[model samples]
Target: MANLRPISRVVQGQRMKEGAGVTICRTVGTSMLRNLDPYLMLDELKLPAKAAFAGFPDHPHRGFETCSIMLEGKMEHRDSQGNHGVIGPGGIQWMTAGRGIVHSEMPGTTDGVLWGFQLWINLPKKDKMCKPRYQDYQATDIPVVESAPGASVRVMAGEHAGTAGPIKMRNPGLLMDVRLAAGANFTQEVPEGWNGFAYIYDGEGKVCGTKAQPEQALVLGPGDHVVATGGSGPSGLKFLLIAGKPIGEPIVQHGPFVMNTQDEIQQAFRDYQSGALQRPEDNPWKGEEL
Candidate 1:
């Protein structure tokens, strides 16, 4: 028996322009104009064979973290810390913007086509300003273990069965990039009280018993395990299985700013307006972001 997992309507990814890049999937998340706390927002970017679609110029971030994962092509990241590198295919870069930081992501070519995923995870209020750090985990550095007949799980956070990922953080969470071949099914447990959700990337499947398509998402009820079964794609189904322990605090976010209070959000805007938010002088790619 499967529960027709509760889900919102499926909407097409719209054309939305952001600071440095364009957004295809518009109107994301549950509420109309509000973002899910803890998990702010998730957007998808697809770049064709050409090189014109390179992403984000130098940008300022306060009180949040930005995650970039190259799904198809290559993405080069440079920041104020004087760090620069290319994340290809399965490579991922997790950056934390505590008090403040400035950085940029420029899309690149690989073979011919280019594709990837950029995820943003919110930082808890207490740990928000700790410090800014960059962790680039090579594809091989990420652990991928087989769980069931036709399913594979890539553990990015939290414990999966007996395996864990190299990408550790202060936030108690789990991020698994899972893939399922047709007819294959896999079930992995989640923390007893962890807040989690599953979003389909390639194919359709049943989420805990409800039917979900690549066009839709499953918010998932309070549970311990997420079940994804393959359906249509002979090419196989891809999804990002992510979960996080709730921080249980007020979230204040405005555009690129994410904080815990209205005063903090206002301060973030003021800082950026005063040019204090950009990467400092003598920093990596100084004065590069627009």
Candidate 2:
């Protein structure tokens, strides 16, 4: 029998304004959750149809990566490296701001509701100054597996079951989008010594016998596997199961920059201000403009 993980801590997302007056439900990076090893922050951006909100404009980042998963509507991304793309529903854009990069994520449609999640993954000290790159995928690019009756899993990164996700990162991790029908259950095996968590986004469910509500992030304790059961609601249950191998390094963050030391953080700011953060010649994005 697999050793089931227990819910170590439950963090309620705090609603706060971000970008250009857009509200976001932040689960990690808050005072309640602080930082989670290799994972830094997770934000749920939900813009209603009636809300007049400006999206995130050009911003700089360094020593980390940003993964954006679009669930509804569309988002356009443009970066200082001359990379441009649009992620529609079910699409994902993973950007590695290794040395540094300035990017913008704006809503592609103003008439529809926009919903998505952005997760920040920290890079180790060695890879922190590496070259910047992007790994983008359309909805069809991601592999989905129906592991059990009424349960569907989308493998976004790392391996799940016998299938592997398309994106590769400096650090090994798992980012799975799971959905369960009423009364259905799904089990996932996590690697030993990895930090993991689940963020419930729709309906209600149970993680290791603990009730999970929307916008709640449940931190998992040491175990070999995790179990999630769907509630009897019409929408069933939808959540993101994410885990990463801990970097075990000191984290010094200043706004969009994340580095190992205070001196590195200050250097990141100086590089951005001096227009020396990104190397245009080293840009790995070769796609056509959207």
Candidate 3:
């Protein structure tokens, strides 16, 4: 029998705002659960359809990567590297701020729903200052697998049913968006020693036999797999299953910069202030395409 990992801790997200005026629910990044190995923060951004001018503006990040997933609505991304693109519903943008980069994430009106998540993934000590890169994909790029009737799993940055996502991470990790109909059940195997957790964003469900409500972050204990079942309610359930290998290094973070030491964090700030973050030759995009 497969060992199901039970929920060890449950934390509720707090309402917060980012950029100029975007509202979000911050699930991670708190002092209690500051750093989850290679993973850092996870922000759930849910806005109204007319939420124009309510998005993240130009900002700098170094020694880490930002992975944004669009569950609904449309979002446009522009960066100092000259990368510009628009990701619609179900699209994803993985930005690697290896050394340093300035970027903005603006929103556009689409349908009635405007929901998304931006996950901050920490880079390893060796790859902290590597060259910046990006991995952008559309809704059709990701693969969705059906485990059983009324249960679907969308592989974002990991492997599922022999299919793999295109986004690559320096530190091994897994990200999956799952949806289950009422009374449906879903299970996924997780590698041992990898820190794993689940964030329920919609409806009700039971993770590892523990009842969970929306906006709850469930930390998983040591086990080989996790069992999640939809609640008896009519709305079903939706969540993001995230797991990553622990980097096991010193973590020094200040605002958008994440480094292995305080001196490195200070240097990142200095480089940004001196405009030495990105070289002219480093940018491959020339306002044509991203």
Candidate 4:
């Protein structure tokens, strides 16, 4: 029998505004939990219908990967590498900020609710300076499996019952988007000893014996399996169950830069300031205006 992992802690994300008044709920990257190995931070961005969401402007990042998943609405992405894309409902954009990259994410629509989640994943020390890359997936590209009536799972970055996410990662990780109808139940196993967490983005339910609701984050203990029960409501329960093997190394993070040591962090800052972050020849879109 697979033992169910219980929730060790439940933390409410702090609400804050960033990037031209864009509101977000930050769950990780806080004082309470600096990081969870390969994973650094998770932010939930939500904007109501008809309300203007002044999106994020150009920003720099290094030594990490960012995964953006859109649950609803639309978002436009433009990067310094001349990469441009838009993510709609059920879309995903996974960007690797190896070395560095400057990008902006803005709202594409104003008539409907905008709901999405952004997760930061740290890169290994050796691959910190690798070439930047992107793994974009549309809704149709993701595999959705109906485990049972009223219960379904969307494979975002891990394998489940032969369904795997399209995004390729330098480090191994799992991100599963789950949804359950009222009176439903779902159970699954996570890799033993892996750091695991689940963020309830919609509805209320019990995750691994802990009462959970929207905006709540559940940190899981060591065990093989996790159980989720849908709460008594029409919306049921919706959440992302994520886990990753801990990198087990020292991490030095200083505002947009996550490196292995203080010296590397300082070098990142110097490179950005001295215009040495990206060499002209390295740019794939150097001569193009984007």
Which candidate leads in lDDT?
2
Where in model 4 is the C-alpha error above 4 Å? 49-52, 278-290
Residue 40's lDDT in candidate 3? 92
* Whole-model Cα lDDT of every candidate shown, in order: 0.68, 0.88, 0.85, 0.85
Cα-lDDT of candidate 2: 0.88
lDDT string for model 2 (65-137, tens) is 9999999988899888778899999999988888888888888888788999999999999888777878889
Off by over 4 Å in 3: 283-290
Could you tell me which residue pairs clash in candidate 2?
Answer: none
Q: List the residue pairs that clash in candidate 4.
A: none
User: Which stretches of model 1 miss by more than 4 angstroms?
Assistant: 1-15, 19-21, 26-33, 49-54, 279-290
The digit string of per-residue lDDT tens for model 3 on 53-123 reads 56778889999989999998989988777778999999999888888888888886745767899999998
Question: 169-227, model 4: which lDDT tens digit per residue?
Answer: 77887999999888788887787888889999999988988998998889989898888
Give the root-mean-square deviation of each candidate in angstroms. 4.7, 2.8, 2.9, 3.4
Best by TM-score: 2
Query: Which lDDT value does model 3 have at 11?
Result: 81
TM-score of 4: 0.94
Instruction: Point out the worst 10-residue segment of candidate 2 by lDDT.
Output: 281-290
Clashes of each: 4, 0, 0, 0
